[model samples]
Target: MRSLLSRRFRATRAVTAATAVLALASVTGQVAHADTPAVPEFDDGFGLSQVTEDREVHSSTDFSITVTTPEVAGQHKIRIFLPSDYASEPGKRWPVTYFLHGGPGNPDEAGTVEALRSDQMITVAPDGGRKGWYADWLMQDTAEGAANWETFHLEQVVPLIDANLRTIPDRGQRAVVGLSMGGFGSMHYAQTRPDLFGHVASMSGGIDFGNYAVRGAVVATELNLTTAWCAVSSSRGCADYGPVVDSDAIFGSPYPVFNADHIWRSVNPAASANLAKLADTGITLYTGDNDLVENHTADGVDIVTSRLDKLGIPSRAVNYGDGSSLSPTCNGGHNYGCWAPAFADYIPRLEAAFAAEETK
Candidate 1:
């Protein structure tokens, strides 16, 4: 968590990828949290076998699970937050909210969900990988063959929760929310598998990757320096973290001059086909005027918000002007301060979606 926050604050200023990686590379060893000891250690989620290292986090309320599946290499870590009354009411099933974190991001980013104090909704957060971008990579070597995030989350994680936990197991009982890159994943997952997630919300997520180079560059840079790549790198007995690859490994190229651009367009939530599938899924998009690199986000969230309006997709739009005031709580840009408030506002809305169906 220390490295994640350090990288975030510095990255907010448009720093180079090398600088960002170097800044946190040293601290990456301090990856696991004391309260949550089960979290993956150095080179976590980037493809390192930390399965035996798994342990429960936050006692009975919030626990972590290591899932093994063919969707991606390495052991997957998921944090599950059960309702306080879960043990008291053994037969009572509950609604679920899937929380996705950002690049170099963890499932419990900034303790966003914990701060919400919960809403009688089960919170299931899966490691979307550090910059996994929640997609199966276009190339194997691109992500060092450790992609397949979408399949892992939807096919493996989702079912594992439903079967093991007392969840409603219906689309109306499920919602997905994420910040930054996970934001893109939530919206795309909902759009692609409308039957899986009934409601979806994105916080400062990059919805249109094709329109902005920064979006692609960010992904490329993060992918290049993955933990899996670093574990094998010729390090001087230190966490090298990466050998420094290129965007080509992930998408072939950052721009649309080549065929790889099509992959970007395809995964984009704002794309015509993607948007077309959202008619049945409740959609919400959020971004702050004071957010870091707000312009690049506009090409994503803002444009998608506009397109949603134009397409008449039932959606909620929160500008959270400058991320000020708690009246209608809106935090600052891409940071957790912004996300905590945004999440505080969105969680109830998500529960309401589930409640609506429950009453029916």
Candidate 2:
């Protein structure tokens, strides 16, 4: 039930930092809400389902937790990589950084455990499933049930990390970061649950799923909603037929189906009513210039940053690119070339945040 370093995926060499990048242009938009919505309560019980050790050259204590979802009856896996010094430091409580993987994750994915082990904070990576997107799925079949990733992570996983591991266990000590689909998940979580995370970053992620074009392309994936997120290929198609996707999934299908105004009111971070709630939270968003397939990613960063600016929320949005215009160290792409360095650079910021909290 547990994996070792022998099961680790070969680490890809991290690319250099981005030297050249784009900046999001100024934009004007009305924020939907001034205060965040209330956090729903859930039954909380977390324990280590299992644990394993890997003595590979770069190995630490590994954890496997089985979480039960709200509607689903099956157990999901959550893998964790403790700090390299965890075993030696018996009484220390390290901070935690949650790392979310992209959609339709590779079956053999071992996460960035090896690359991030050197950091002092524990790295938590959960199996969000091929299409979970970290959102509570609407139970389509009462018999089988849906994957309630949101509840499992917030209610169970976070508590388990604190109870079982040497963790600071404070909201100010927690951080979350992700790439692509995981990026969207990170922002959504931070926006929805500001009490749980102090810092959040999204690299090459889609934050504006309310946009029909963005929604259509994302849901077009076999893992997402398939044909449900779209009726025709055009944004206008959503106007005539309401939303093409099921209302039960992701956000509940409100009455006004076709209008994005209702569908993403509670979900889309960039367009949600609680967008201002992230003002106090540390926000870092970036995307690669050469991410052709997900070109809208950078645009999503722009949308959130713009809204944050209007609400007086400070954030940094970097547009990384290949060394063409400036002395670029990081290459622009959707793969490891961009994500690796972004993650590497972010860890220090997380540490600093925790340090600042300790002083206060």
Candidate 3:
């Protein structure tokens, strides 16, 4: 009888040891905090086979995915932030937010990634082509084919996310937000593809792409390398112009709205023609009052908001701070510092818009 009791006791201790180890694992597996969801690295929604991921270039919450599309040159890299439960709950669907980075920036910027690290939504940042302006380039070539950044995002990236990830996959569940060049991109994409995104916000966005002065300044500053090949050796009659200024790649040359042949009229958000299209969608614009580039940033917001008002379309435009919106606290000055706060403030409003649409 004593021997029998010892065997039972030993079994109980073994079970207890296993249980304790499991409890510790459960605690450590939580991604952020105890309450945070623990997503799996691979699931029906995402896996190593569907979109190739770079493990080396990742944060605690973010990772990179690469895919090749017919629209642009070579393979494109998209940085994605999956919520904690992303892998843990395979049956759940989440809203998606396409975050466009500013000009001269790419998907790997830590500051931008940090801004979105804790977001519960599935956040995606595409390769903005550095200075691709998120538009289809005129005829830039890659080994695969002509570079079409716009088509890649609209046609390829969105669908891939929907197919591979457990996304809501509806117009009302998606939002687009951007800063600087990305702001222009968000506006362009939202207006062009109203069926894709429900809420659109631009923080110090290049909204008024048709503004000649602004476009000129942007082209000079961003694409400053003057190439003689553009002016002297163009069989297509394309001059050595700033990508937006004279090249047919963007708005088709001759700068801002020529009365006779305004090629850019339809796409120019600042113009009455394009602003009219955003009437039904949730629209918001923000800029720092002290932004030196207010002529293009805050002023663009003012111009577009005024046009929307005239058209009887509801929109919100805010110019924050009275002095140079430069912050000693944040990076400030038309950069990620200002952009981070703008995003924090804007996201709640965007979520409210989504909720309102669901009720409707």
- TM for every model, in the order presented, reads 0.77, 0.72, 0.74
Residues 268-323 of candidate 2: C-alpha lDDT, one tens digit per residue:
88873667878688899877665443457777877778888888888888776551
lDDT of 1 by residue, 201-317 (tens): 887777777566545445544555443222111112213223354565554456667565777777778886788788888888777766334445655766786777788887887
Which residue pairs clash within candidate 2?
Answer: 17-330, 228-244, 228-245, 242-258, 247-253
Ranking by lDDT: 1, 3, 2
- Overall local distance difference test of candidate 3: 0.64
lDDT of each: 0.66, 0.61, 0.64
- Tally clashes: model 3: 9
Best by TM-score: 1
Per-residue error (Å), model 1, residue 85: 1.1
Model 3 segments beyond 4 Å from truth? 1-60, 110-115, 141-145, 225-246, 256-261, 322-332
Clashes of 2: 5
- Cα lDDT tens digits for candidate 3, 1-360: 125576576456445543453233323253223232222233222211224333233444566766665566555677888777765576878888898876556776534535465445788888876556777765464222455778878887887778656888888889888877788889999988888987788877878865765565445533434331111111132223223323454544535444622645656778887777777778889887553454457778988998899999998887875423534444334655566666777777776666676668
